[model samples]
Target: MTSYVEALEHLNQTVELHEKWDLEKISQIIARPNATNIQIVGTNGKGTTALFLQKILCAHGFNVGLFTSPHLVNVTERIRYNANCISANEFGKVYMELRDIFDEKQLSYFEKLMVVAAEFFCRHPVDFVIWEAGLGGRLDATTAIKNDIVLFTPIAKDHSEYLGDTLEQIAYEKFFVSQYAKKVYSSPQSQIVQNFMQKQAEIYCKEIFFIPQVSNFYIAETGTVFDIDNQKITIPMLGKHYAQNAALAWNAAQQTLKQKFSVEAGKQALENAAWPGRLQIVQRNADKYVFCCAHNMHSLQSDLEVLKVLREKDILSKNTGVIFAVTRNRPAQQHLQMISKIFPNIVVTAANAQHPIPQELQQQNYAIANEFGDAVRVLQKQGIHDYLIIGSIYLVGEAYKYLELEVRS
Candidate 1:
């Protein structure tokens, strides 16, 4: 048998064939003997919300563990401590110990990682664990854990095949985490999601906290300011959507701590919170490049809004070239339509995988490239400035590697 690191590499090369619910054996292996405080974050803002909560809790003197999915560049980015990626040595050590158990039981890649993360936290004794669901909430491996608080970010149309078709059906699947949670907090979603969540709340007997939408948000070239829980706070991140994510994270942290969060603490934490590959700016040859992993149509729409704001403010220009790609699972037409609306000059390319690309796009643009490096080379050859890379996380990860930007510490 190969080492755990080698096994992880092999797993990444193959397609994920196991069901999400089949992770029960792995979960049982990592179950802590003590009552572990858990919060399962779902939907769009899972990474940001989890990072924010981890920062706030660490400030308040709590050991925090955050597990997020679809790492930007390295697999180690998926597991973090207060916004910092764990070291490769530490990861290898943990994997070596857990590999024995996994090999004995034959756990999947995701399942093996979950068990290692849980056992690492148990031994280290973290005060709270923020676990982001890999996919939809219903059968997600993270759902196996009993949660102290469950958080649902905006439920937009995404992962249609596995989750569902309509927004209501998708909302129902995400709400499944509430069953294992003591309480739940959700941002203001669509009417369908709100209605579904209400029904689920009643059945689960869990108190649901709704984060009201921010009526007034101020955005500038430097950052953004918004009222979260009636406290006006300035964050070092752009986008009106980020304010909503922060609000949800704030409410969840307050609920978990069972106290009014310090305004100064919340403000500082929000300012410091960082999640790479989402509206993240990279500088190359004195030009700005924005790399976002907007795989689904809804997420792409959000990124488009931010780009529009930037263009209006002269932060980004209309001539900015877009490096776009999509996975086989997503709706390519909808993604291309929405992206074309925002970015007039897009260079469509394929991510470094066997994912399908639309034939129509291939015929129209003739911009398809075999690998991420080739895609970057093609964009650079065109003398394009202010580049924006959008589409699947795999594309964003490859771009991150090419740019060599350090992951947030």
Candidate 2:
């Protein structure tokens, strides 16, 4: 695997999670970073929260390495040094070194990437390292490495097959990621999830801090403003949900640094914070597209709320329709129904051949397309200039590919 393409090909050999035996083995062999390890575990906002915290810490002049999953554009998105993704050459070089260990342990794709990130972070020593769990945290590959601080972004029911079927069962599984942490912090969550997390904290003899209520919040066309603990900060992204995620990052940074935390720096850092595939607006010639990664029911609902707010503010056009696609496991019909509430004009399409639109859905009233490009053409033919490409992250990736959008980081 001398090239990035080849490395990705090798990694795809095993896409599913295997036992942790391989992860445990890699954990022992990798040169672990001495930086404070913060594990982010939750169903949604994990990546955004991690990005916010990384930006906050980096703004305070601390070197930070962040590892996030399910890259929007490139594989290098999983590993970052000082918030910059590792270059393909560097990713391949490091991945090449671990080929033997990868094969020896029969490690899954995620496990292999986790080790690569660990090694990459070790090579580029930083003051802090943020590890975002790929899925439910307890048995997630990131948990294989001990963490000093654990942060939970709103827990919700997702990956029911692997986590559980009920909300309590799912939240219980995510709560374990904070068991070994010296300190635990979380964004606002449902009462049930909060209760379970509190109980878990008690069992671990740890104190868990929940981000305080937003003193005030406003969603604007430009961005979302949040007033927390008398600090007025505005994040580049829109929506109250994003404001809450920023609040979580703000509090976590304050607690992590205590006296060293700078309110001004943190506020400024959040203002510049941005995450891909979360209501991201992309312009393609004369047409405008908003790509959102609302794969599961929870995320789809949350994003629809944002979309509703946007529509009310005139930030999103009334004529803006949606291009919906999802993975095989997702509830496509349910997601389409949710989107239809705010966007009745939708075109159903598949992110890839492996996850095609269900046959039943193909017979529905909605317009159908073969792919993202076809979806866009279908909308354009109807004189719909503005579009919302909403569904799985892979769908956003496909849309980006169709637009030939380059990965900035």
Candidate 3:
């Protein structure tokens, strides 16, 4: 294909069905068993948590291949090796090698990417292949590869249509990744999910442990600092969730490296670890911007709480402008109302045209900005110096494009 986008378009011509997902064929195509697979499964925070783990492993000087889904900008962002995005040229070239498999096996869009990521990782000297499940774990394409260590992020009610409708059910579906895991780590989760995961581990005869509670846990306008495993860690991030992610990465790395790993290396990893679009901060002159990827209600609540704390500390202005967008399937109005409760004025727009046309926010203070430039214009005209764009990662990409925000390291 001429371009990665074109290759995807061509793949779209294939019918969408399970018959196209021949994992057996995919495995044979990229048969390399040198890499240890790490599957991170969750409803939210999986991307950030996976990045956390990847960053720590890289800091320890391990070759890491990381893959996450639903790219905001280029598709290459979904695949990386040692913290570097895979170039489209390389991605296209590798994918072309398996062109016949695409036609013969009928791999769907997501399945195609999974095979592509696996094949690319196999060709490299990657020591750790961190695969972040795109959705439900059991039937996810990544599940085709049995993981050596499985990290469970916070699983809540998301993708209910396919996964399940209830929290317990969703949690149960996600824990399937742990069935074959040699080791398992849990991020702080709801009581129901934590219990469900423990039960699953019992059935699988695998021991599962949650990230130990940190001592002297503190969140402030400056940053977050905590003590875990007798190690003092500081991450310059707003939320406690980030600190928990750091601990998960640290624990997982410790489990892998054993005595060779040092507390000092863990601290350095946490300090430098950052996942863009997750409470990401950007500045333009005197004005400031905070980009958060709050997709579902669970994540939205978490990010809102962070903002609440920031507002209370007077770090973030009590009043600000919001650029909000959500996927079409979700109730746009609910997100609008929730965001309105904080920032009354909002610019409602589509993150990308792929999203269903956004419903007009039927509020006197809200404006519809189809164009990113127009969205910025509305916020600028309102004299809102502090701006927050949230709801969907795709929307964050759109805002980043307009603002020219640099990609995170």
> Please, what are the lDDT tens digits per residue for candidate 1 over residues 1-409?
2454664664464346544356466557776524345655556877777777777777777778888787777777877665466677777777776666776776667766777677667666677788888788777778778676788888888777787888888888888778877677888888878888898789888778898887579777666788876777776667777778888888777766776466678778888776777787767776788878777766777778887888888888778888888877667777777877777777788764656465766887547776777766777788776888888877887787787877773
Error of 1 at 300 (Å): 1.2
Q: Candidate 3, residues 1-409: lDDT per residue as tens digits?
A: 4866666666656566643345466555554437889999988778877887888888889999998987766777888999799887888887777778877776777778777888888888998999999778877778778789899878888777778899888887789878878989988787877887788788989899788755687776556888877777777766777777777878888888898787777778778877777887677887888888898888898888888776677667776888887775676777778877877878877777767345444443567888566777888887778888888888888877877776765
**Root-mean-square deviation per candidate:** 2.4, 1.8, 2.5
- Give stretches of model 3 more than 4 Å off: 1-33, 360-365
Q: What is the lDDT of every predicted structure here?
A: 0.74, 0.84, 0.79
Between candidates 1 and 3, name the one with more favorable lDDT: 3
- Extract clashing residue pairs from model 1: none
Overall local distance difference test of candidate 2 = 0.84
lDDT of 2 by residue, 1-409 (tens): 3577778788877656533444456556666688999999998888889999999999999999999988877889888888588999999988888888888887877878888999888888699999999878777778877799999888888888888888889988888877789989988889988898888788888899998767678877678887977878878776777888888988999998999999899888898888877887776677888978878887878788888988887767898978988787778889888888888998889877667887878898978899988998888888988899988888898888888887553
Question: What is the TM-score ranking, best to worst?
Answer: 2, 1, 3
Error of 3 at 138 (Å): 0.4
Candidate 1 vs candidate 2, lDDT winner: 2
Clashing pairs for model 2 are none
The count of residue-pair clashes in candidate 2 stands at 0
> What is the total number of backbone clashes in candidate 1?
0
